[model samples]
Target: MPDLAAVADLEARLGRPLTPDEQARAGALLADASALVRDFTRQEITPVTGDTLVLRPVGVLLRLPQRPVTAVTSVSAVGPTGSVLGALSGWSWDGRDKVDLSCVSPAGSWPLSWTGPLPDTYQVIYDHGRATVPPGIVAVVCAMVLRTLLSPSMTAGMVAERIGAYNYQLQQGTGAAGASVVMTSADEKALARYGPRRFGTIALEAG
Candidate 1:
């Protein structure tokens, strides 16, 4: 579903080749991992282009709705009834975390004097995000899925002995996991290595 990682990428992380069956299962796992990463970071992994906006807040940063924003088509504000308020001239996009709204045009700006928050007031039509998924994120996904695939029993909670005794314990086994939802320390390590997108007062471009 999400093309964050390739089958070859998954195979590389697995340190082996994937069977025909594994390939099908790997697709599901990769899709799950992609969604988890986006939710975890509160960042959009998919690329999208449309009109979006942000309201004025205490901080100078106005985080775009969808990010990392690839391009800003236009920046403007609208009233509750969708009336044109004003446009920011000296504003900037960090390309990741936020758009620097340093310049506020017109004193009677919406929310500055009216209701509704900034994230709702302003309108920015732009192409947001990238198609090239981060390698770190890909690695993280593969590692997580690999763990599940390598431990189907552990993930399935099938630790019971084959006998009626019902005794169970974790043991090594093999199978491609349908999905990997379990977060492990390794996942955190991978994310830390990649690091989160930093946000700050950025210039008009190159952020």
Candidate 2:
């Protein structure tokens, strides 16, 4: 879940309490966020190997095979530095499924796992000297998710929070570098918290 203090900070930065009209817009954006998360979980994460990649509503769980020096490429979205995409032995999910990708690495690999989902629409491409999966696909998935979750009335603050949540999840999972996935369980919780507020606010404040 997003930090309440952080939310307040966001509002402060925006220099205003959400207007009634802004609240209405925020609510709509929240609804879009909920829907986008749902679609991404259903369409992209679930069909993949749950053993290697656990897809929950909140974020994803990835298990590294061994400790090795691996280079994560095509992570333009994360920045040019290419964050730490080392060998993860395992990771812990809040309430999502557990996936083991221990078989995917070579010997002497530094094993480590990330525990979160994507933030906004970002990607982390892993280059293992072989054709694996492109990180851009994850970015694409994130873009779709964001698009699905956005609305015209969404407040800048609310949208920022949603985007922050998304980034927080992804950052938690892959650290600075790794493949991205979604945590369906946590995401559901997020949906519950943000969804109703988003939709209900529209009705309550609109009138």
Candidate 3:
């Protein structure tokens, strides 16, 4: 069975919601499992190489420190309503090459669409409330996203180690407020190719 499918099954078998601590552990496991599956599936291929994966750029051009050669092919945002706020085929990089999807901010002006340079790694933004999102679910998604970006040669163990570092960032409160899960790609090229597409962007309004 697929790693995600297996995770779903595990959740079902557990028969209980996960606490914060439990969620962290589960996320780590899910990350490793997903990486394994990806590697197995691509065994016949030439092996996952940085060049094999195409990274796109977005955001503003003047902001880029140096001119980029690539173009942005697609831009998408994943929210509950399924709306397309921004559209871009490519963008030039400035000093700011960061995609910030940390908190559940109000629609628009929140950079629902923009890009810059990619990072050397993936950065995850996790919100405060562990209520709706149990630790296990968070772990699974984080692992999957990281796998999607990482090269085939990179092991799941390495991903877990990176995740551990990310968790520390979360604990330090250096990330955006109320962000349950946020990820920034380390490879600037990745952002240039695949713009930020929201699978689900939750918005919270004050009463």
Candidate 4:
């Protein structure tokens, strides 16, 4: 995956051109920043087509791990022995990543009732993700990289020492190498919508 932000984006934020050293380091900073954001959000946040997701369905309500699912091409059930049992029907995309097995199938029957097994695995082939990266996500990535790029070498904490009126001070908001790359609480809030679903997995249905 490419870095979410670019050198141009960093230059734009800084309102000045990067020196040669800064330019050389920007790539690494951007890559680290993008990885951190993706890690925090647990999303690709990029468009993909014909993506496949496999699930050992825990319940009638199946949630796809990706976002903005545009289409479902097929669903198959595989037995515990690893043979694909057959094609599954009646599952419908719920506009996002969820699939409802309880829906009426084209054959006019609920699809949740499997003929032969406990712990059947489902393979879903689908199209999902955004056509373009969201602006907010890009902004967040830029901010994180910029912070690291511009930050002085120091950690964000308190330091105090008093010896015969000697005084020395190191400012806050600075940290060890790579410390600025962490996703802060604000970043989490900004990315909550893009993060993984919070719903608890229900026990598998065996009807």
RMSD of each: 7.0, 21.4, 20.0, 6.3
Which model scores highest in TM-score? 4
Off by over 4 Å in 2: 1-13, 41-207
Candidate 3, poorest ten consecutive residues by summed lDDT? 60-69
Q: Which sequence of candidate numbers ranks them by lDDT, best first? A: 4, 1, 3, 2
| Model 4 Cα shift for residue 114 (angstroms) | 9.7
Q: For model 1, how does the per-residue alpha-carbon lDDT over 19-53 read when each residue is reduced to its tens digit? A: 88777677777777777777676566667666454
TM-score: model 4 vs. ground truth: 0.73
Which runs of model 4 end up more than 4 angstroms from their true locations? 103-115, 154-171, 174-180, 201-207
User: Could you give candidate 4's per-residue lDDT for residues 21-50 as a string of tens digits?
Assistant: 778778887888889888888777776677
Q: What is the lDDT of residue 152 in candidate 2?
A: 24
Model 4: per-residue Cα lDDT at residue 85:
54
State which candidate, 1 or 4, has the greater lDDT. 4
Residues 1-207 of candidate 2: C-alpha lDDT, one tens digit per residue = 111122233244456665665454444443343345434332221112211211112233232211121433221112123333443333322222123232233224332343343221122233221133233322333332333233222232222234543532222232211112223444455334222111110110100
Which residue pairs of candidate 4 clash? 154-174, 154-175, 155-175
Off by over 4 Å in 1: 59-61, 65-67, 81-120, 154-180, 192-207
lDDT of model 2, residue 185 = 47
Candidate 1: clashing pairs of residues: 52-124, 54-118, 55-118, 55-119
